[model samples]
Target: MTSNEHELEDERALCRYCKAPVPENEWFGLEVTRPVKMPDGSTSEVDVDFLDAVFCSQEHAALWLAAPIPPTVVPQVTVFPRWTRKLQRMIERGRP
Candidate 1:
């Protein structure tokens, strides 16, 4: 493999939504946390880093959080049948 490819493979972050590989300088690190119960029956915050999730930009982060909008369906309308007699008359009169 090429040197750049090797370097990227060694150090790169994937976008949480699009799964695009992000470089170190461009990596948007977002600290994701979850509530956990402690031994004393108290709630505590725990950082989740299983995926090591990161985004390419803030826009991607927003998109990842927002729900996707569904596509709208349009009704199709067919044209009426042509008038054969009127068309024939118009052709005969050289008006067409």
Candidate 2:
């Protein structure tokens, strides 16, 4: 067989979205952009790209694009102690 075919035979990268082995020919880089809303009601942009793109199938691409954000489990914030709040108030008053 050809060298390209040999390389494809050796390839085993899988698509994160679909869990299928990716082929050599369809490998490509994809740029993803997400829009953000500012406090002033204006829109901003954020973007990221896959370090390496390898697609097992077109369905893999679709699923990755539609994945939901993972949840974060941060501890809840509590009110500051009375003494700390008083110290903060004194500090703020001292500032001109």
Candidate 3:
């Protein structure tokens, strides 16, 4: 194989949960959109690739998914935040 091809094959992604090296050919994960509240009170949908949190196998992915979400340590403030339609309806109904 050419040097470039060999380099490409050596590329690996670390699994998010186990931190195991996952080769490029064995990368397994999900592509998700995350909504970020901008400073202008607008939300943007960011397309995230598997590289952000890749997995070596489906079991690892499942384990990661089933794990409890940890509380955020960073303090963030969202002023005049943009709310989704469902949340808006819930607010109108006086439901927290």
Per-candidate TM equals 0.44, 0.35, 0.43
What are the per-residue Cα lDDT tens digits for candidate 2 across 17-53?
Answer: 6657666577543454444445465554552322434
lDDT of 3 at 35: 52
Q: Which residue pairs come into collision in candidate 3?
A: none
Instruction: List where candidate 2 sits over 4 angstroms from the true fold.
Output: 1-11, 33-53, 69-96
Clashing residue pairs in candidate 1 are: none
- The 0-to-1 C-alpha lDDT of every candidate, in the order given, reads 0.63, 0.59, 0.65
| Cα lDDT for residue 31, candidate 2 | 55
lDDT of 3 by residue, 1-96 (tens): 999976765666678889877877787775444455555756556522122458989998878877753322323665454566767889999999
Error of 2 at 88 (Å): 22
Best by TM-score: 1
* TM-score, candidate number 3: 0.43
lDDT of 1 by residue, 1-96 (tens): 999988877677678878888767876765544444454656555422222358888888777657442222223565544766777779999988
Residue 4 lDDT (model 2): 95
Candidate 1: regions farther than 4 A off: 1-4, 37-52, 67-96
